[model samples]
Target: MPGYHSFTANIIYNLAQLGIPIRDSEFFDIQTYLEIVEIHKNVYAGETPSRQATQADIDTFLG
Candidate 1:
């Protein structure tokens, strides 16, 4: 089964597709992680497993 790191890998991969470069360390940093979680919640809404993020979501997070 896919675990936490795999999940985070998915996040990183998707973000990179949007030209939003992110470091592995940033995912563990409280501030950056919280921002990512917030943007994630907003993007996925009620989706349980959290879908792969889109460029629009990344743009929103960038703003």
Candidate 2:
């Protein structure tokens, strides 16, 4: 939780550089990020980025 504020700040800065206006509300809430990261972690489990983790893997992990 302590470092998460930095993540949100970086997201805001990146979007702002693209001329996309963002409020703090636009950043993912902690719960949402946790959900998404859980999904991503499952997707990437037992694979490196070069390996292209699959939906099947995600489903398996979710299961």
Candidate 3:
């Protein structure tokens, strides 16, 4: 986890704050759901532009 940012961790924390359920699984379904929710939250935060990263951006970084 050396290079990992806290983005996903923060999403999980926020989900907990909103009374959403979380569970650990081999497929990580809950974490995936929360990540999308977090992205939407950032996108619709009422700004002139959105800072939510695109899938291509993520793909570039992943590559």
Candidate 4:
């Protein structure tokens, strides 16, 4: 789960850049962090949960 941990860290870093306060411990577990990430990805893609995100959508969100 190291990769997931790294992903979570990146998300935390990005949120910090946006002036959002999020503690690493708040994620609780990898599943929780992943779910949050998915939700954010969907929002960034301007899609509903039922919609799949394209690579471009993911790239834009990552950037």
TM-score of each: 0.32, 0.35, 0.30, 0.40
The residue pairs that clash in candidate 2, if any, are none
lDDT of each: 0.70, 0.66, 0.68, 0.69
Task: Write down the RMSD of all candidates, one decimal each.
Answer: 11.0, 11.4, 14.4, 10.0
Cα TM-score of candidate 4: 0.40
For residue 43, model 4's alpha carbon misses the true position, in angstroms, by: 0.6
Please tell me which model should have the higher lDDT, number 2 or number 4.
4
lDDT of 4 by residue, 1-63 (tens): 769999767977756754546765464666765676677666677854466889998999999
TM-score-superior candidate, 1 or 3: 1
Q: For residues 35-55, what per-residue lDDT tens digits would candidate 2 score against the true structure?
A: 655665676676855766699
Clashes of each: 0, 0, 0, 0
Tell me the tens digit of each residue's lDDT in model 1 across 1-63: 659899878777766654466755454665775586678658776667857999999999999
Instruction: Tell me the spans in candidate 1 whose CA falls farther than 4 Å from its real position.
Output: 23-63
Badly placed stretches (over 4 Å) of model 3 are 1-3, 24-63
